[model samples]
Target: MSVLVYTENWDGKFKKLSFELVSYAGKLAEMLGTTVTAVSIGSVDQAELQKLGNYGAQKILHVTGPNLDKLDNQVFSSMIVQAASKEDASVVLLSNNNSGKAIAPRISVKLNAGLVSAVIKLPVSLNPFTVVKKVFSGKAFTNVVIKTDTRVLTLSQNSFELIETGNKATIENFNPEIDTGLFKTSVKDVEKVTGKILLTDAEIVVSGGRGMKSPDNWGPIEELADILGAATACSRPVSDEGWRPHGEHTGQTGKIIAPDLYIACGISGAIQHLAGISSSKYIVAINTDKDAPIFEAADYGIVGDALKVLPELIEAVKEVKSS
Candidate 1:
């Protein structure tokens, strides 16, 4: 039996999370005394596919066919299940992101595998195969034991480090029977926010909140993000007010993120907002109010007007970069 990781690609390029999954799967495979295999869908560069070797995939099963370019949860899940069966995968790994969230559960049901999502670490004990996972919006953790022989797990982003093994991986074509009917829903077109770090994958993120006051006031926030090479995000109320896109919102009702550094500007620390970013390695909060709830969760708290403070922060970062 082998450990199989589903490597999802976006616009023909693999995201950092995919590499992280491969590395994590490779380590687990070593612990389990099994080889690691990667299953990828759609079109990706041969060189890019080969790079999986550095992260510890011994083999890659690439599935390419018509209507596979777009993401259809049912179709993608079917493809993964078929590949896993062919590889005799005893353990399957996935990234607990948007696509993985959609496809993992379906694959689990089809394969009769016990699934654990939002897994934070490798199994503490493999005999019983107990894994730790985040619960209650990442405020707490729970250890879950998988009793099934076939197990599937979705790793939370930023929870694992990527290690290069320098081993070359062989690629094989995997053609699975496709139900043309699954293509009932097809992607007509795709829109992407180019030239910006995706929030989910960003190492550093600078976020704004209602405290920015108005959409026009976002110049400072964006400037700070640009200086730091960080992705820009906002709190729920900022999105609800149309100052920022809903996709940029981070809170219980928006996207969950765990970046290396998260800078919150003018946002009051509401529990909902904290739930989304509590996992960040370091948090910096800037607000005029000294007693804002966010200060309680912040690693570093600054009591100042964000509009005045952000420009100074940006200048300081620029000076450091120049020096």
Candidate 2:
């Protein structure tokens, strides 16, 4: 039995998320007494492909072709299924991000594999392929046992450690025979949000809510984020009210992020918001409302107006850095 991990790339480069998945797959492969095969779908450079070997991929499959750069859900899923079949991979792992969420179910159906998503840990038992993942909106975890011979798992972001190994992986150019008719979609226009830290990839996040009063008050939030090199986020209401961009929204209906440190200023922690950020290692809540729900989830709490508190917080951070 071999392990297959899908290493997603951006602009022909691998991100920390890919390394994290490889690390998880590599450790799992070790536990199962097997090797790991890393699969790359798009145009990734040889140098970038070699990096997966440092994370314990014994073999790397680089699949690139015409129209493959643009994501066609059906084609992408098909490619993974084919790779797993060729590699005889018993376990498949991918990030529980947008692509994984969309394609994992399809891969499961094609492989007839049991799928467990949002998995935070390695398997509990290799016999039945039991895995653990957060359920009930990250409030609790459940151990799911995959009864099938093959299993597909989606690892939560920032859930695992990136471990480098000495293994130098052999890279193979994989070109699968596919009917061009499957390319039902064409590239229209591509727009990217540039010059800002991506929320999902940020280790620290500074978020604010309507209590900042208006969009004008967001300068302090941005200043603090810049000082700490953190990503700026906001509660749903703040985004909906146009105080912040919708892309910065974090909650049940928005982006789910697990940062090392999450600071919520002027935000009341509704369960919806907590559902997105509850996995943070440390939470700091600053709100004037003593009974704000955010306090319950915070590792540290400060009861004060956010507008007054942010400046002091920024200054403290600067002083600490200077010291």
Candidate 3:
């Protein structure tokens, strides 16, 4: 019995979530007294794939095929199902992002295995593997046990600490024959979002709200985020008002993030927004209104204008970087 992790990549480079999943699956491997193997489809730089060994992956399987380059959810899921069936993986792990959400469910149906989403912790026992996951949109946690023959789990981003080791593993190229003609959808083009850090995998996030005054005033937020090497996020109203793209919106109806440090500026904490980011390890709220609901959930609060506070924070970060 072994743990198999599906590694997602972009443009021959690996995504940060890959290391996180590898690290997490390594822990599960230890619990089950088995080894961890990573399966990656498409063409990726060999150097990037070999780096998985640093996170405790004993073997990295690279499936090279021209058709695998483009993401067809069914194709990817079928590849994973094939690998899982051949290896008899006791547990298969995937990151709960756009890809995993689509692939895991289909794989579950194909393998007839129990599936868990947004899993935050590892299983407690092997007799009947049980995992802990978040539910009610981060409001609470639940313990679920899998009684099926196999288990498939999708972990939430930023839920586990990525472990690194100096060990390097051997990479093997796998040639699987798949009938590409059966693929239902084809990827036309990947419109990449420009950013040094991805919001889902970022350790720190600085988000703004409508209190930003106007779209033009957003320069300070970007400057501060750049200085801190953090990703920028916006509130629902800001996205609705066209101040930022809907992709950057963070709330109940938006993308959920769980960074190590979350800084909320000029936003009154709405229950919906909190539901999305409440899993952050530490939260800091900055606003002029002292009684704003954001302060209630913040680990630290500053009663000041965002315009004034952001620049100071940027300067402080610059000084720290310079030192």
lDDT over C-alpha atoms for residue 202 of model 3: 80
Q: List the residue pairs that clash in candidate 2.
A: none
Ranking by lDDT: 2, 1, 3
Clashing pairs in 1: 269-294
Q: Give a tens-digit lDDT track for model 3, residues 160-265.
A: 8889976687788876557868688866777877766778878899999978889998898888878788999999999999999898899889989999999999
lDDT of each: 0.93, 0.93, 0.87
lDDT of 1 by residue, 1-323 (tens): 99999999887888889999999999999999999999999988889999898899999999887777788999899989999999999999999999889989999999999999999888998979899998899789999999999999999999999999999999999899888887667677878789989999999999999888999999988888888889999999999999899999998889999999999999998999999999999999999999899999999989999999998999999999999
Instruction: Name the runs in model 2 displaced over 4 angstroms.
Output: none
Off by over 4 Å in 1: none
Better candidate number, 2 or 3, judged by TM-score: 2
Which stretches of candidate 3 lie above 4 Å from their native place?
A: none
Candidate 2 lDDT over residue span 27-124, tens digit each: 99999899999999888888889999999999999998878777888898889999999999999999999888988989999999999998999999
Q: What is the lDDT of residue 137 in candidate 2?
A: 84
Backbone clash total for model 1 is: 1
lDDT of model number 3: 0.87
Give the TM-score of each candidate: 0.97, 0.97, 0.96
